[model samples]
Target: MLVPLYNHTVETPAAFFLVGIPGLQSSYLWLAISLSAMYTIALLGNTLIVTVIYLDSTLQEPMYCFLCVLAAVDLVMASSVVPKMVSIFSSGHSSISFNACFTQMYFVHTTTAVETGLLLAMAFDRYVAICKPLHYQRILTPQVMLGMIVAIVSRAFISMTPLSWMLTHLPFCGSNVVLHSYCEHMAVAKLACADSMPSSLYSLIASSIIVGSDVAFIAASYNLILKAVFGLSSKNARWKALSTCGSHVGVMALFYLPGLVSIYIAWLGQDMVPLHIQVLLADMYLIIPPTLNPIIYGLRTKQIRERIWGLLTCCLLDHFSQNS
Candidate 1:
């Protein structure tokens, strides 16, 4: 486990990561444990999605290709933040170095931006598939998919880089206790010993750019997709369209709604909740989406369901063959 590199005096977690305040009890530990379990499930879930997609030759279409990217982003997003959370909860020490905290903040939000872009791409892919099936191949070719990934990653980092730099430039004269599981933007900004007005402004702008723009594109793409899908007069065509859009819609709602809520909380100065509750709810940002996303895809997509069972069967047979 990676331990904190810097200390404020002694090495005990204060305020955010651990429930180590004067009156807190064992229930907090249980909550952390539950979150750890959730992270494990997220890891497995995203891994399974990646594995199935990579292994199945038939899943080489743009939809699954975008889903593979989504799964990979979820994998990183969950992994980048979770181990630190587990460590802080288990050891009751949440001290992180300035550089390390900035790095964490960058990667977590970077993955988030990547996720938003991929979701938009997915919405666009669905539009092509349903609205212009004949042109789908030309529209979303492999080279085009690669360009999309590069663009998503590049644009995300470009938009958020200033916010990452803002963390380092701010002076932390005294306060070091972050008010959440990991080094999130709001928590880290609140920890600044100096006034965080500049950092706060930068974060707001970056969020509006990366998160805000991605969401706008996603909503717009889906709006057009809705019109096209509904234009299909046949019931069977309607069902197919519904089925195709269901997973993307569910995943988008799962990710963005809570994220928007968190922005609200951060804006409201965490809204008078105990730091513990805030931390728990904040931790939900990492937990819920990754675990549920694969399940959402599996439930909505016949190919994914079949692929999962096929993988399960392959694993069982491999185990039996190895044993025999």
Candidate 2:
């Protein structure tokens, strides 16, 4: 048995063992390979998005600015969990120090909230560009954009702070084994010797409020945007406006659907869904979105696509010239 961080007098364990997926120990090799592949793609894709946007002056609009933030959030979200998860599956070294686990938990939750906020911001950007074209620049000026990003990050930190705080206060005795991949809030809380209802309830409520409200606002923005698009007399204009939003809408669906499913399974579907499926969904929720966001944007958004193609062409030419 693993040694406890403190003697019987203590409440928390020194390290927690993470079981990647319960009852699937035999599949650890394949699981590790899959996660490692997806994580590599996520790192490369999001990094390229951020780099292209930063280097290309023509892409320095509000939409691209928010895309850069979204890429950055995707990077943070994937980095927070995937490396340790891959290690757990590949090496059977599932032990995570108490501080490291909480830190991972904080980054995972905070980046999730920040991503939701960014989606809302992007939706608003689309709405302004489509609905109030004349004021797009004025409405989302450098000052306003900066303020929005700062507020989104700050709000996430403030809201998610309680999750870790509540977990810390609870008395964790006995088993330090976390059933899910990483140190998820509810997973760790359930190990506490004391009643964990409050922590669970708080997490559910906070997630609901943050995701629910942001989604509602995003819906409202798109609703107005649609109305404005239809009002346009030119068919080409309508298509152009919608094409701009297609990537954002796709990204939102990719993010919110899996996230909601994971939350539901964690909070309510314990008896309905198998434990392994629930853990898989939770892992995919973090993995899939980050892996796909850049692909969706790079292919759907014309400017980004052209810029990426140019960059690739330059690299290929440089490599051939060096060989010659």
Candidate 3:
């Protein structure tokens, strides 16, 4: 009786239920409004970034090219996961098909990996621009930049395929409810009846290779950048060089630190951390970076800020004209 019941349970859960927050049933309205605001901001900000970069031919440099890549990736990342999450929170319907869950997991992981790679590319661009100003153009030619984008996207897709395949094959004999709003690889894996050690190990290895190594390379690039900046004879030159990298560095820290912490707690201290805290951190790991990235990059870079100001002023003038 027990064996049959176990088999039936494992095979029966065709869909998984997603609970956005475990103890927040009474506050779904507030949560939905907050999440909707975040999602809207992320979408609008990234879209504006892409549009500004495209419209202003002066911003056609490699840095802006990579910025476009980052914005596009953030757009996809937010779109892939947030709408479903908002719907779940708003309507109180949490059921997601197993196949849909895996699809979401794949896009989330792939876009994240692509963002990590794009960050590394941006770091290298800065390194070349600052450290080897004479050779920057030759090093990051249009052809080369295109190749890097292709490689970054391809690598992300290939790396996640095996992990997603493994996840799809897992038999989820336990409860079909996922505790978080989105389908994280580890979150979903935890619900499987089979031993998920292999999946976890693979995830660790992939993350190390994609995220960890990119971080290491980014740090090295920044170190070289600092050394070069300090070597400049003029203080203004030094300040300008440092200022150029400030936004990228801030974005990197915002994205990686929370991510590392979330990964740590998810794997090691899942029981130690409170469920609410874990859920918040998990959501922030994805949402905060995309939401803040546009603001940080936009305000810090003069070209983007000027374009944004121009656009905003034009809109205001148009509104006033219509009202009058």
Candidate 4:
């Protein structure tokens, strides 16, 4: 543990190699193409969401502001990993510098933590809007929304900094080849020659604390929402209320379910699970949510759907006029 202070002189590799889907090494070209497509879609979708929200004054509500934050986070998160993943798959040049690896780890965790906070904030926004409509505006004022964003980012930074520091301080004397497409916490931790117990425990505890609490809060908020929806005498009102929450529920499920499954597979199926399967699950955990989030929101939320249609129509009309 204390070896980090003196280990600079030790023969540690300056960079670590990312072994992306060891079994698919023969078809990395095809895999790269597929992943590139997904990355492109994610980038386009999230970018469109952010841009539409910004340009459409009607979407300047607290709910859409939180959504913009989510899309931005998703963009950063996808950007942080997918480009490197593409490079590794296409060129087979998977070497990432030690400093760079830690940086990736930091950003991945930080973005994930921040996204969770944003989801919770979204839940709160929904709760206020649906349950206490009168005070919704009062509760989620501009200052409060700004403060929530600041708090979300700040909390993620404060929480994940120590994990990165711990990883940096660990002495790595083992093979520098990481067996995944990205720099995951446990994957990197397990590479250290030092006792990785503390790192493992910290990762588990931190994830459990943050994820658990966010899930609980979101669940509680939804419970209240459900109660409010059911309490209404009108069946149409109930359906409308449920419809408003459908996209959020879909997003929350998309974000968490695969994540939980990936964590279990990574932890429990380390030896039994095929490397490709684990890699796929892990990649899905990261990419799927970002890729689908915008689509779900745009399709399920009437306001966003109409706004997107209007924007697309405007673009097409402009394009035709310019050509004419």
Question: lDDT for each of the candidates?
Answer: 0.74, 0.86, 0.84, 0.85
Residue 119's lDDT within candidate 3 is 89
RMSD of each: 4.1, 3.3, 4.4, 3.0
| Runs of candidate 1 exceeding 4 Å displacement | 1-26, 243-247, 271-281
Residue 233 of candidate 2: its Cα lDDT?
96
Worst 10 residues of 1 by lDDT: 13-22
Each candidate's clash count? 0, 1, 0, 0
Query: What is the Cα-based TM-score of model 2?
Result: 0.90
Give the number of colliding residue pairs in candidate 1.
Answer: 0
Ranking by lDDT: 2, 4, 3, 1
Per-residue lDDT, model 1, residue 130, is 71
Worst 10 residues of 3 by lDDT: 1-10
Give the candidate number with the greatest lDDT. Answer: 2
Clashing pairs in 1: none
The 10-residue segment of model 2 with minimum total lDDT is 1-10
TM-score of each model, paired residue for residue:
0.85, 0.90, 0.88, 0.89
Q: Rank the candidates by TM-score, best first.
A: 2, 4, 3, 1
Model 1's TM-score against the true structure: 0.85
